[model samples]
Target: MRARNFVSVIAAVGAGVALVSGCGQGGASGSSGDSKVIKIGTLHPMTGSNAGDGAQLQHGAELAVKKINDAGGIKALGGAKLELDAGDTKGTPDTGQSEAQRLVSDGAVALVGSYQSAVSANIAAVAERNKVPFVMDISGDDAILSHGYRYSFRLQPQNSRFGATAAQYIKDITKSKGRPVTKIAYLHEATAFGTGVYTAFKSEAQKLGLAMGPEITYDAASVSDLTTQIAKVKASGANILVVSGYYRDGVLAAKAVQTVKPKLDAVIGAADGAFDQPQFPTDAGSAANGYFDVNYHLNDKSAEAKAFADLYQAAYHDKARASAGFAYDSVRIIAAALERAGSKDPGKIRDAIAKTDLNPLSLSNGPVTFDEKGENTAGLPVLTQIQDGAPSVVYPDNLAAKTIVYPAPVQ
Candidate 1:
């Protein structure tokens, strides 16, 4: 039986290589025996508020599955190719619950995403009920792991850690220069991700002995203008601004800050809404420079980072975004768990996933090992500051690419 399995594995690998090499193979063909296909489900917002980033994440995950299948899939699973069953979450929690149920009912061995925290929270029950391992690629709600869901796994760093990273970076920079520590204002959307960051920053600031400014909350959806919110933040006489929301609000906040020209010591935030992507820099102008923020992985040129970067660029024809790395790594982590289990059973897969210790650069916030609560113990969020057009890590010395650059308030 072992000999027969070895032969099947070799045959599958050869077929996969041939297909990748552009030989006369249309696509991956299954062997005529047990372990036919490894079906996984992805619940992502193909359309809705967070669609821009969510769509990119979905594509990255799809690309990872394609590459895995092209490389002969899982040899231990009798050369079964990875197959993805994706559901459009519509970026809402209500839709997310229905989609999760549908995917589990359809017999998916594992589940991948629901980028928004609201969506993830709504679908988490379904995944738990079916014992399906839900790998979160984007949602960063603190309650995600705090609830102690055994089957839930998150590849991204927690929201609270990210908030702390950003806040600490500012605190360190100010202390080093002996600047007056006046006030810190926190801005957050009324979403789970936003609220998590808001709470963490407030707590960390108080611990650091920084004055906590009036915390401001905004509606993520339908908040076209942020004049009032910005005015309130400026009135607080805060030296630092921590915006904990999505990209749309980030743009609005940047514009509003420029118009008000408040005396801010620093402007930073958690990674959720802060990358200088597309036209953010062009739109924000000088405000884009020296903007401090935090993200899950660094876009370094190290070997591991390069390997994933090259493959991602080759497959997608663009630089991988923050969420893309999470999606790709989430699939890879799930794949490793499946390989270890040697079975499609969700219970075993969940156990294996909790034991994974990957060093993939695509998920460099830290090690991939998860504790019983499904939170990664090996990782902590990194602080970054926008220089030129990209975000480079500046905190956690080992992973950092450059020294921390404090944002000098425009005189």
Candidate 2:
């Protein structure tokens, strides 16, 4: 049976236990009643290499729950408060799946999480099997949604979208600056996350009549040094170097580029994790300057986004990253689903989520809407460049926060 409808079959069997146990009453351990509180699960790597990003995702969801509750909770459900049951995946697929199962068993009607694509895939399966709605906050690999699971949804553009957009942005910006396109070197982590992006980027770059070569790969978890990789890129005679990888490895690649001094026209990132991060400049030091990344980012021009960012900063004492914005939106989407469903039943919530049509605070092409595959067709990514020690949107003219700086100055 379809996961969305499958929940109905089990709802009856579970209702008695739910009522007797008062699920999610006391932090999902046991509480007052389902009418008083609705529980949602947040899965992320809380104590691993990606812990930094995971914490932001959790914080964003927390802030959204607080915002909704402060505004009087879900009125349709008689002011029922939303509770978050956070689970740490430790950046592993096994742990992610286990945690997802635990959260649903505890009482989460809907779930959001797992920054890494692989981890998200595992959690997606758990959600599907348990007949709970799974909303992705930031996992980008397109294959995650290729399965015909109706219970899973995504708020971010797929990796292929990020790659193609990056290629187009590079072509436009370079040509506009009178530099035009030339040879490009690609470096990415050897994982579904990085490889998925590189594959699409190379195809799109080729389609745009841009030359690509010197593709390099490294293990994000074990690789500490990228000097050898950067040296290959420098020798490739490529004028543009495109990188795709996670934060720590991305920072390592930046430092390698600095040490190697490739003298490329521009060192850019295609769906790169570190290039668009708030802490990248501080972590990569001088190596971070002039780097560009084509990926999803917060719409700084949106008044709502501005307000949200301010609140996030005041609460966390740190600038909100794009990943956090998605997390916040995920929670809001769940709340909207809860309000619309008017019931804590997982089946009803899943159906309501499938019909979501709401404006998102993130930089999107249009109001959030999901296709049959649960991909947010309205989702879009923007190009950002680290200028003046901070990343700023620099492309798409409409969302440009700063003008393009082409052929980056030599360090």
Candidate 3:
């Protein structure tokens, strides 16, 4: 039987406790050119806490698969069409493992996903044990790549890189424009992703001689109000505010800023996917204005990135922010490896991935190359400011499509 024909049980990602199922659909439609199908699994938080992030990643992967198939499928595998065998991790480690087995049993040669850092770690372990190539989309925790797992690879800049980038970007902005950003406050969720970024940011900030104001941590999903956190940050006389959290946190943070009207000069987020969400500006209203999200993202100025953004916006009615772009690139990276290997063997695919050197023109970070640690060396963070109700690249001059809104007018 063709690998694509194998259908496995899909978790009821939304409900979390139900045993639901579906067929392997590459968004599944019959294409005349390729009779053979290559199934790629996306194990992500399709439901539960990080559901929004999971759905965005899933759509990005789907879009990539569709684009490949539309372009006459993979020529190396007898014009084999790509198929998606997605599993929802439901925001849990146990479900991530079970779903990993399900994806492999259902015939996935390679896997991509589980956006949450904790879930991604478990998925990475399963992929390693089974010897399947795993392409990561968006989990920034540093430990995910420290395991020495050969089968696991990441496309996004890891935690250390992200934190360092934030510090450097702040320094650069201050140096160039003389922006007074001496003391900064960090308010984040208490997750591996949040704390890891905070740790890295703190280290880098100290190295750059920046003062840390109040370091406030909260639960991204459970926390209802950040009023106290924002008040404390304000009281610390922090001119700059850094936040790390998910969608709800982003909204709450922005609302708190609006309510408290802190004498803040700037508010930056550390790849807190929520700020990149379409609903962020709407939910946060004018408060989202001038907020910058510093994380690895597609180079908006690149023609190729712009084109993909258009496609993604059309499909999802939302911007192809970093998370979506990360997902698309993860799938495309696997596809590129498959093409290079010119075979269906998982081992061959793994080798191709290890040797990957994607041209900067193809991705935002420019030159997608994985180091010995399975981290994309060229994957660096970009600075994006919420401008005119949408997020636009503002710093790292080359990748930025728009200029920074200095002295953020958060009126």
Clashing residue pairs found in predicted model 2: 25-31, 26-30, 26-31
Task: Compute the lDDT of residue 134 as modeled in candidate 3.
Answer: 92
Q: Per-residue lDDT for 1-411 in model 2, tens only?
A: 001111232253231122111111225646535568888888987776777787788778877877787788899989988877878888889999988898898888899998999999999999999999999998999999999998999999999998888899888988888996668999998888899999999899889999987889998878979999999988988899999988888899999999998869998898898998878999999899989998888887799888888877765667778888899999999999999999898889989998999888878888899999999989978888899999998889988999878888437
Top model number, lDDT: 2
Higher-scoring candidate on TM-score, 2 or 3: 2
**What is the number of backbone collisions in each predicted candidate, taken in the order shown?**
1, 3, 4
**lDDT, candidate 1, 1-411, per-residue tens:** 001121232254342331111111112233222367776778877666666666567656765676677777887788777766667787788888988887787667898887789899877878988899999888888887777788898777788887777777667778887885788888889888898887887778778888888888988866887878888988988888878877767878877887787788667777656553434576667767667667666357657567666665555445666677778778889888888999889999999998998875543544678877787776556676667766677676676777766545632
**274, model 3: CA deviation in Å?**
3.1
Q: Tell me each candidate's RMSD, in Å, in order.
A: 7.3, 7.7, 6.2
List candidate 1 stretches off by more than 4 Å: 1-35, 276-286, 362-366
**TM-score of each model, paired residue for residue:** 0.86, 0.91, 0.88
- Candidate 3: 10-residue stretch with minimal lDDT: 1-10
lDDT of 3 at 123: 89
For model 2, what is the alpha-carbon lDDT of residue 124? 96
Q: How many times do residue backbones clash in model 2?
A: 3
Tens digit of per-residue lDDT, candidate 3, span 5-109: 112211111111111112222232332223487878888777676676776777677667777877777888877778777787878888888888788776678
Query: Model 3's lDDT to the true fold?
Result: 0.77
Give the range where candidate 2 is weakest over 10 consecutive residues by summed lDDT.
1-10
